[model samples]
Target: MRGFGELEAAVMEHLWAFPDGATIPQVHERMQADRDIAYTTVMSTVHNLHRKGRLTRVREGRKHRYRTTASRAEHSAELMREALGSGGDPRAVLSHFVERIDPADSRRLAELLATMEEPPR
Candidate 1:
């Protein structure tokens, strides 16, 4: 969500929610209910995201059924890692992010990272 542009995030959210996946029209219809967006606009957004490796689609008759290529957590983690590994001040960024979390959430994130640090053969 942090690195994704507005339309990209919205498209991802739609795919994540629609587990069965959907065609451009379906996604456009669902999203248009909330916002005054054009079909071509949604279609363009979905195509651009697909080109960015954020979406995958299967051919269904004459239409393509689109879905999220990765889970929300997986995408977010990849974005976070890219940001941290960009040679910037990761420590400062992390400190800022940690400061925004509740104490309980900070502990839970620490525990999750600790659990993930185990070596695997």
Candidate 2:
């Protein structure tokens, strides 16, 4: 899978904030508070997200309430894993990634890694 575009990202952020789910009109209304956007644009974006399998929808009266297939954190982890497997040496990529992070984050990562159980063969 690929990352979201500008408008798509905005829509996803709004949807993520609504854990229960949101309709196109609801998302469009919230987004209009920040920027000038058309309702149809929001509608199309949400529909495209559903087509991409990023979102699921259920009929709510006359509108469809949409929800993300995964949580925001899960999506971020998937992106990280995708990047890690993209190319070249995994260790080298990880080493560079570690080097770029702040000390606190590095320490936190180390702690988490230490606590994690190894996957079964």
Number of the top-ranking candidate, with TM-score as the measure: 2
Model 2 clash pairs are: none
**Candidate 2 — which residues are off by over 4 angstroms?**
118-121
Candidate 1 segments whose C-alpha is farther than 4 A from its true place: 117-121
Q: Tens-digit lDDT track for model 1 on 1-121?
A: 3467898788778888898888999989889888999999999999998898778899999999998878888988888788777747989889888999999999999999988998886
What is candidate 1's TM-score against the reference? 0.82
lDDT of each: 0.87, 0.94
lDDT at position 94, candidate 2? 98
Q: Residue 34 CA error for candidate 1 (Å)? A: 0.6
